[model samples]
Structure formats: structure tokens, C-alpha cells
Target: MDFYLTALLQGLCFSGIALGIYISMKIFNIPDITTDGSYTLGGVVTAILLTRHLPGYVVLPAVLIAGGLSGAITGIIHTKLKINPLLAGILVMTALYSVNLTLMGRSNLPLIGTSSVFTFVQLVNNPNQNTFLILGLIVMAITLLIGYLLKTDFGIAMRATGNSESMVRSLGVNIDRMKIIGLALANALTAVSGYLITQFQGFTDINMGIGVVIIGLGSVIIAEVLIGWLNITSVWISLALVLAGAVIFQLVLAFTLNIGVDANLLKLATAVFVLLIVSLPRLLQVKD
Candidate 1:
């Protein structure tokens, strides 16, 4: 039970990244790779500020700004300088390694005695339970915000830009600007994931975000599969499923570990699971 609970907490921690990927990949069709770096950037910023006894509220905005800046840089390169989106994201993600290391002044920082966002939620004696509550609220707020944004005129334009760039541009919308803003929002949410994870886990490591994009991709794919099967058309329900998808992904992983899979092979197993998720629909369609 505890094991599953931990995975649930982890899923909530990663819910933001899943949503970030949804925006950039699902909505905008931009394969932004800045998620890896921006994730670590959030953790690094959170750890440094928490160590300074700063409030969680104060630390959060800083992480968001940092992540937004990283995404915006990729956007500028892709839109203005004509660099490929993938390469621009790669460049920014690469540079963020040094930035994160410099911020931490080391490869990892432990928050053994530090007070975090969960510190205030004293209703639960179990720390993990507290984490669940805190992260739950955060993810809920973000989901609603994203849903609201998608319903707005500008949000509809953004979606149009993603679906048919030429058509949106013909409508007098600045496609490049939309791309930039979209990427910025995507990465900012990714950073929020990092922030919550760092606080929950009580530490920040430089490599904590390595290959994290795969995890986000897996969660979104899970949501996609469910949304299709259920024919869920409500924006709010769709967003909620995305969050549930994150939890389900983590729960699946935890169940695998509990079944006596070797810890060292976890990444390989994760890759296999993601690949299956990616290919199953096609395989089933072919069967038809």
C-alpha cells in the first residue's frame, strides 16, 4: 500500500510535465525538448530558495520565470532565427545543465531539515499523505487554468495555430508569437512539476530530470488512449483524465516494481511500456 501511495505522489508530482507535453506536442505539434532542463531548473531553484528559508509561494514564481525563459529562448530561436524546434530545445536544455549545476554548486542538494510546501499541511501526520494533498491541489488548479485558457478566443487561436499554421497565419494571427507563448507556457508548467517533486522528495539532483520527457510522453499517451476509448469531449473531463493518466502511469510502474522486477531494469521497462502505448493503437487498427 505504501509503495502504491509513493507512486501516486510521484504521479501527481509529474502531472505538470504531462500537461506541458500535451500543450507542446498534442496542441501545438511542436516537439519541444526543453522539458528535461526546465524540470531540473525548477528543482534547482526550489532547493536553493528553500534552503534560504524562503516561503514556498516566493520560490514558485522564480521557478516559473526561469522555466518560461528557457522555453522562450527555444521559441525565439525556432521562430525568429529559423532554427529547427528540436535543435533549439536541445541547445537550451544543454545550457541549462551548467546553469543548474552552478545554482546548486554541486550535483545534488539534500533538504533533510528544510521546510517545504508540505511543511504547512500539518493535518496529516504522514508526510506522504501531506504531499498527496498539496500536489493534488496544485495539479487541480493548473488543470482548471489550462482548461480556461483553452476556452478563450486567444486559446482557440492557439489551437488553430497548432492545427493549421497557414490558416491561422492567413487569419492575421502571428504564428511565431503563438508558438513562443505556447512553448513558454509548456515549460513553465514543466518547471512546476520539478518544484513539487523536489519538495516532496526532499532533495534536488542535477540528473533528476534526465529522460523525464519520456515519462511525460508516456502519461500523455495514456491519456490519449483513454480519451479516445471513452469518447470524452468535455475539456474539463479531458484535463482530469490527463491527470488521472499520470497517476495511472505511476501506479503501473509501482506495480511492476512490486512484482519483483529488478530496480536496475526499471528504465528499460519504462521504455518498453511507453513503446507499447505508442504502437498498440496502430497495431489494433491494422488488425481491423
Candidate 2:
């Protein structure tokens, strides 16, 4: 039970990344790789501020700004510099490695006795349960906020810019600006996941964000599959499913571990599982 509970907490922690991926990949159709860097940047910033005895509220904005700037740089490179989106993201992500390392001054930074966002609020005696409640509320609030954003005019423009860039551009909407803001929003959300996960796990590592994009991709793909199957048209339902997919993905991983899959082989297993999820629909369609 505890194992599964931990997975659930992780899922909630990663909900932000899943949503960020959904926005960048599904809405923008740009496979922004900045997620890996921004994620660690968030953790690095959070750990630094938390160790100084800063409040969670103060750390939150700092994480957002740092992550947003990283993503915006990628966007600028792609839009103004005429670089491929993938390569722009790669450049920013690469540079972030040194930035994160320099900021941390080490490969690993422990938060053993430090206060964190989770510690700031004491809702219950049991730490794990308190974490669950806090995480759940945070996830819920973020989802609602994003859902509302998508319903606004600005959100519609963001979606339109992705769906029909040329058309939106013809309407005098600066598509480049849209892309920049969109990536900024996406990476900011990804950083939030980093912030939450670091606090929950009580540490931050320079390598923590490595290959993190796969988790976001897996969650988004799972949500996409369900959206297609149900022919869902509602934005709120789709967003909710994306969050659900994050939890479901984590739970599946936990179950795999529980079933005695070798821990060392977990990454391989994750790749294979994601591949299966990605291909199953196409294979079924071909059969049909």
C-alpha cells in the first residue's frame, strides 16, 4: 500500500510536466526538449532557496521565472534565429547543465534538515498523508487554472496558433510571440513539477532531469489514446485525462516494480512500455 501511495504522490508531483507536455507537443506541435533542463532548474532553484529558510511562496515565483526564461530563450532561437525547434531546445538544455551544476556547486544536494513547501503546511500528523493532501490540492488548483486559461481568448489564440499558424499569422496575430509565450508557459509548468518532486523526495540532483521528457511523453500519449478512443471533444475532460494519465503511468510503473522487474532494467522497461503504448493504437487500426 505504501508503495502504491508513493507512486500516487509521484504522479501528482509530475502532473505539471504532463500538462506542460500536452501544451507544447499537442497544442504547439513542437517537441520542445527544454523540459529536461527546466525541470532540474526548478529543483535547483527550490533547493537553494529552501536551504536559506525561504518560504515556499517565495520559491515558487523564482522557479517559474527561471524556467520561463530558459524556455523563452529556446523559443527565441527557434523563431528569430531560424534554428530548428529541436536543436534550439537541445542548445538551451545543454547550457542548462552547466548552469545547474554551477548553481548547486555539486552533483547532488540533500535537503535532509531543510524546510520545503510540503513542510510549510501541516494538515495532518502523518507526513505521507499530509503530502498527499497538499499535492492533491495543488494539482487540482493547477488543473483548474489551466483549464480556465484554455477557455479564455488568449488560450484560444494559443491553440489556433498551433493548429493553423499560417492562418493565425494572416490574421495579424504574431505567431512568433505566441510560440514564445506558449513555450514559456509549458516550461514554467514543467518546472513546477521539479519543484514539487524535489521537496517530496527531499533532495535535488544535477542528473535528476535526465531523460525526464519520456515521463511527460508517456503520460501525454496515454491521455491521447484515451481521447481518441472516447472521441472526447471537451477541453476540460481532455485535460483531466492528461492528469489521470500521469497517475496511471506512475501506478503502472509501481506495479511493474512490485512484480519483481529488475530495478536496473526499469529504464529499459519504461522505454518498451511507452513504445507499446504508442504503437498499439496504430497496430490495432491496421488490423481493423
Candidate 3:
């Protein structure tokens, strides 16, 4: 029970990355592979800064900005250089590998003696208080802010660009600007997730982002499945579903582990779970 609770909390905390993936894949119709690199970039930047005695609040925004800039570069390359979106994301993600290495000043950074947002949360000294509670609050705040932003005029333009680039351009919306902003916002959320994860896990590794994009996609797919593929009428509900899906996914993982599954096989399990969920609707339609 304790183990399941811990996994649930961790899943909820990491759901921000899933929401970011939702925006790129579902909303913008973009396969953003840059999330893999940006996740590590956020962890590296946050860990390095925290180790250097920087405050968590300040480092948090810096990590977000760094991730946003990385995404913006990918958008620019795709929009201006006429590179394919997938290829552009690949290039940016590849570049971020080295950038993350430089940010950490090595292949990995240890947070053994460092202070993080989690540490501050623990300072309350309440036995019942935990990092998950603090992270949940942070995620909720971000979700609300993003929901509000998506209702604004610029947000509508961005959404229109995703729905039909040509139509949005005909309507005098700057498609390039919309794409850049969307990508930046997506990666920024991803970075923040990475930062929080690093603090929760107590270490940062360059290779930690391996298969992260797949996990994000899996989470989004699972969320959509749980919500019955409903058109996201309310932004809050959409975001909430993302988080709920992540928690459910983690619970599945926990169940596998409890059943004597090899830890090394977890990725395979995740892949299979994602595939099953993604294909469920199609299978159901055929059955009907």
C-alpha cells in the first residue's frame, strides 16, 4: 500500500511532462522528440545550479527558460529552414545531449549535499508532509495557468494554427510565431517536470531521459483511453486527465513489479501497455 501510494505520488508529480507531450502530439500534431533531451537538460541545469548554492525558486524558472529556448530553436529550424518537424526535433534533441553534458560539467551530477525544492518542503518538519504533496501543488498551479493561457486570443490563434496551418495563415496569424510559442511552452513544462523529478530522486544522470518521449506518449494515450477519447471540452479536465493517466500508468508498473517482473523488462512492458491502449479504440470500433 505504501509502495503504491509512493508510485502514485511520483506519477502525479511527473504528469507535467505527460501534459507537455499532450500539447505537442495531440494539440499541435507534432511528434516532438526533443522532450527526451529537454527533460535531461532541465535536470542537469537544476541540479548544477542547486549544487552551486542557487535557490530552488530561481533555478526553477531558469531551467524552464532553458528548455523553452531549446524548443524554440527546433521550431525555428523547422519553420525557417524548412526542415521536417521530426527531423528538426531530432536535431535539437541530439544537440541537447551535449548541452546537457556541459550544463552538468560532467556525465552526471549528484545532489547528495545540495538543497532542492523538496528539501524546502521537508523543512516544515511535519511527519505527514512529503515531496509529493509539494509537487502536486506545483503541478496544479501550472495546470491552471496553462488552462487560462489557452483561452486567450493568442492561444486561439495557436490552436488554429495547429488545426490548419494554411487556414491560420490565411487568417493573418503568424504560423511560425504560433508554432514557436507552442513548442516553447511544451518544452518548458517538460523541463519543470525534469527539475521536480531530479529533486525527488536525488540525482541527475545524462542518460536519464532515455525513452522519456515514449513514456510521455504512453501516458497521454493511456489518459485518452481512460477518458474515452472525449473531445477535450474543458482545458482543466484535459490536464487533469493527463495527470490521472500518469498515476494509473505508474500503478500498472507497480503491479508488474509486484508480480516478480524483472526491472530490466519494465520498458518493454511500458511499450506493450501503450500499444494496447492506443489500439483499443480501433479494436472496439471493429468489434462494433
- Per-candidate alpha-carbon RMSD to the true structure: 1.1, 0.8, 1.6
* lDDT of the structure predicted as candidate 2: 0.94
Model 2, 149-233: lDDT tens digits are 9999999999999999989999899999999999999999999999999999999999999999999999999999999999999
Candidates in order, TM-scores: namely 0.97, 0.98, 0.95
Which residue pairs collide, candidate 2? Answer: none
**TM-score-sorted candidate list, best first:** 2, 1, 3
Q: Candidate 1: which pairs clash?
A: none
The numbered model that scores best in TM-score is 2
Q: How far does residue 225 in candidate 2 sit from its true spot (Å)? A: 0.3
Reference-based lDDT, each prediction: 0.92, 0.94, 0.85
What candidate 1 gets wrong by more than 4 Å, as runs, is: none
The model with the greater lDDT, 1 or 3, is: 1
Off by over 4 Å in 2: none
Model 2: how far is 126 from its true place, Å?
A: 2.0
TM-score of 1: 0.97
